[model samples]
Target: MKWMPFSFICLLALGGCQAVPSSLPYADPPPSQACYFPSAASSTLTASVDVLTEWGFSLDASDTRLGLLSASRERELHGASDLYASPHFSSRTSLSVFGGMGIGGRSHLGVGLGGGFGQLPIEVERVSLLWDNHHVRVSRDIRRFDQYGSLRTGRSASTDDFCARFQRALDANTATGDSPS
Candidate 1:
């Protein structure tokens, strides 16, 4: 016999379960829930981008312009709503809060998270993109080994030099904006 009762129960179980949506819709993430950003996100993220650029990426002056464009778009996507909600969002843009949208803020926040943890004091994502997706410092020893290998092969600069160069790039960016991005 085919265990009809068991099959019937299985069928009911399968049919009764609701499909999980691919994404949870934003119904105003509960007001009680505050944003908990991690502390190392900025430094770690800055370090990562600095490293990427130090290795091979070409982050020229035009790259800065692109960063401005991207940061504009990013703000539009992630923090647009937050920005638009505030008339004092910047020293300029006196009445920009009226231009609010939700996507920009979300994009900015998501990108920011990728560089490190989440508690970065500056805009690490924008900095990374502007720096051509490299970082200045590295936490893992193997990464240093990778750089050393490149040097051994005569295809890379010294690790300390790379870090210093990356540091300069990051510093340049930090000085440009009102906030250290």
Candidate 2:
């Protein structure tokens, strides 16, 4: 009887599995969380995204096959971060972090996970990840009202402004005339 397969499985299951490496080439954390985590992270990225958000991603999807289905698969997600980008803000800054998992080896079932972050043009940031061959990255840059705008105008319209606007819209909608029964 060949016990090799059983031994290999035991080793992997017992925390002897090798770690998975990051897929990006960036040297810092992603500037925004929404873009990076969503884009690069594998299917089960919510928890990591939440943590990054809690840590701040405004800085800040899925897979199948190989039985890596998010719906009915037993898996674990791991994430790592370095304060490479400092909590500083410029016209454009970036925060980058990597998230991924070591799916089971030859014996264990498939596990899926991945993530990454990147920013550009001193304002637009894309923090994303890739799962196997799928692209799940996203971008969160300052929304531009006019192409020929100055720093003042650009600063006035950022994710923060959008959030504030959204909040106001929600408040106005619920505060006065509309209430769900």
Backbone clash numbers for all candidates listed: 28, 26
User: What would the TM-scores of all predictions be?
Assistant: 0.19, 0.18
Task: For candidate 1, give the lDDT.
Answer: 0.32
Runs off by more than 4 Å, candidate 1: 1-136, 139-158, 178-181
- Which candidate comes out best when scored by lDDT? 2
lDDT of 2 at 14: 80
What does candidate 2 score in Cα RMSD to the true structure?
Answer: 22.4
Alpha carbon lDDT of residue 134, candidate 1? 38
lDDT of 1 by residue, 34-96 (tens): 111122233434443454555544333223333221111011123323322323333222332
Give the runs in model 2 whose Cα sits over 4 Å from its true position. 1-43, 58-122, 132-181
Please, what are the lDDT tens digits per residue for candidate 2 over residues 51-166?
33443343223333431212111111112122222232222223334334555554444443322232221233223323343333322333222111223212222244433433
